[model samples]
Target: MPFKINTNLSALDAYNALARVNAQTNKAQLRLASQLRINSVADDTSGYRVGKELEGKVTLMKAAQGNIGAAKNTLSTAESALTNINDLLIQIKGKIAEANDPTKNLTALANDINALGDEISAIFTNTKFNDTALLSGSALPSSSNFVFQTGETEKTTINFGTMNTLDLASISSSGATSSNITSLSVSTLETAVQDSLGKIGNYVQRLDVKDDYLTSAITNATASVSRLFDADMAIEQLKATKGQIGQQVSTTMLAQLNFQPRSLLTLFQ
Candidate 1:
């Protein structure tokens, strides 16, 4: 009620209301433009912190998904190489069985068998991708196995596990006289062939397990990324409605402020 030259009380009250409304309008404008309630750290510090943690989880999960991809490729290569080896064993077994019969030419059978051994060796030597041979013996001075490490926490190794390097060597005519081959009957050759198939089957099983693990990781990562960055349409829609009302209120408050300073005009009338 005090008459002051510089500050009219009614004008000051109107202006205070207008300023509050303006602040709300600005907030609404930002939310509408960004389509998000939490655009800046100032809007919601706790939300920003939680979002950062979720973002980190998304990054790690994505990397794990990639690790699974590389692992699958490696296992696939191994499976393919073993398949070739199995096929070779089958051919060798059939030839050896025919050679064992008196009706077949023993000398020609020996040549064919020797040729097969050489072919299997060739398969082993040639089975490589990205400069890494899957079938070849590891030349690591300390061991016959090779460990594939993706990171400090994850690793998968190929042990050539008990591949018959000896049986492979025996496919030659020079090694034909060995008891293992000379004594090999139709049943024995069949058993050897089956054993080769078994090794490949075992490797494939392990790959299946690895594949499953990676598939799960990819799914989880995909979900986490969605949670961290995706918007909620329902929540945003409600906010947009509220923002519209706030802007209107701000404009009305500004009009009221202008009129309050003009109250002196009523005295002149």
Candidate 2:
């Protein structure tokens, strides 16, 4: 090799190697400090995109879980009201049966029945969830469908049909007589209460299942995001150590190569 004082090719190569090592060391240090493998889109383009997608899905699932909880609470409130209504109907049925007896005061029994009916109507007016009437035959929010986002691209919904309202006061017993009590269709009211209870029970079960699914989906999605974005501290520490050693050695080698051109002065001596 011809010795050149003006330009040392060996020194230039060492400098380039040192720069590469320093860049690698900085990258490893950044990864360690941030605790993330892909801090930016430039770190891992495909991984970053996929991880962000998974993160979005996790966020959506968490929100859906909250919606499911609110829906469950709404259904629970409605169920409680329906249960009370059912109990009142049962009491009215008993009162009607008592009115069928000749010895019982028909006026008092009629008053009791009317009072129970009024209470049932009050329940319809008072039963609400989050200031929205749940059992008043009103159209439910979200277009009669209680829609909840269960996934990034999917949704679950419950339709509280218009058959929810019950006007028990309209079933009158104005004639205070055994014949009137027997003619009253209390069985129809019982059936309506049972049907409403069944619907609410079914909806509650569905919401519970959806809530469980969303919770599991969020867990899995979070894990997926972690795998794509989170850094392995052990691996990064090792890589950083190697990069530091490489940088130190390359810098030392560059210094030595720089002195090689100075050794050409010895030839002139």
Candidate 3:
């Protein structure tokens, strides 16, 4: 090869190699310090976009999760109220049956039936959750988004018309006579209780599924973001070490090459 002092190609090559090594070393160290794979949009544009989109979904899913929880609480409240009312109805029916014994006091039995009916009326008036009447046949909420889900809110209508049988006060008003004892029936109230309980159960089951699904989705989504944005500590440490060695070697080589043209003076000597 012909030696040229004016243009040291070998030195230029060595300098370029050093620059590459320096760039690699800086990148590795930055990744290690930040613990992130994508430091900027330019690092991984597509991954950045997709990860950001998933973050938004995760936020929305969390909100939906809270909504579902509130909905379940509401249903639970209504269910508890109905259960209490059902027990009271059972007591009223028992009192009516005992009225036929002729051994029990008819006036006392009538008072007991009237008291139970008053309790049932109170339950109908006071069965509420968060100040919203649940069993009064009023719509739970005007807004459809009250309990937001993935695409929309889950809407359910529970009818409480059978609650009408809760009143045994009229027949047993004057006395627990034979006519009154025979006419009073709590079967309708029992059926209504079963129906409302079943409806609440169905709503709870659906909410449980959604709750489980959201939990899984959040975990999976967070993992996806980690995969795209989190740095691999072991790999980054290796890269940083390798790049550090390359940087030292390339810098030394560049210095040697830059001074190598001085050897050409020996030819003149």
Identify the candidate with maximal TM-score: 2
Q: Per-residue alpha-carbon lDDT of model 3 for 93-163, expressed as tens digits?
A: 89888887878887677777877777776777787777877765364454212334532244434343444
Residue-pair clash count for candidate 1: 0
Q: List the residue pairs that clash in candidate 3.
A: none
Tens-digit lDDT track for model 2 on 1-269?
88788888999999999998898889899999999999889999999999988888787788878877887888788889889988998898888788778899877887777778778777777888878877664544644566666556667676655435444644443433444665565677678778878887898888778878888888888999989999999999998999999988998999999899777778889
Arranged by lDDT with the best first, the candidates are 2, 3, 1
| Candidate 1 clashes between residue pairs 3 or more apart in a chain or in different chains | none
| lDDT score for residue 262 of model 1 | 65
Kindly state the number of residue pairs that clash in model 2.
0
TM-score of each: 0.73, 0.91, 0.79
- Weakest 10 consecutive residues of candidate 1 by summed lDDT: 139-148
Q: Compared with the true structure, what per-residue lDDT tens digits does model 1 show for residues 90-136? A: 77778767766777776676677777767767766776666666556
Write the candidate numbers in order of decreasing TM-score: 2, 3, 1
Q: Alpha-carbon error at 62 in model 2, in Å?
A: 1.4
lDDT of 2 at 213: 83
Name the runs in model 2 displaced over 4 angstroms: 137-145, 161-165, 171-179
Q: What's model 2's TM-score?
A: 0.91
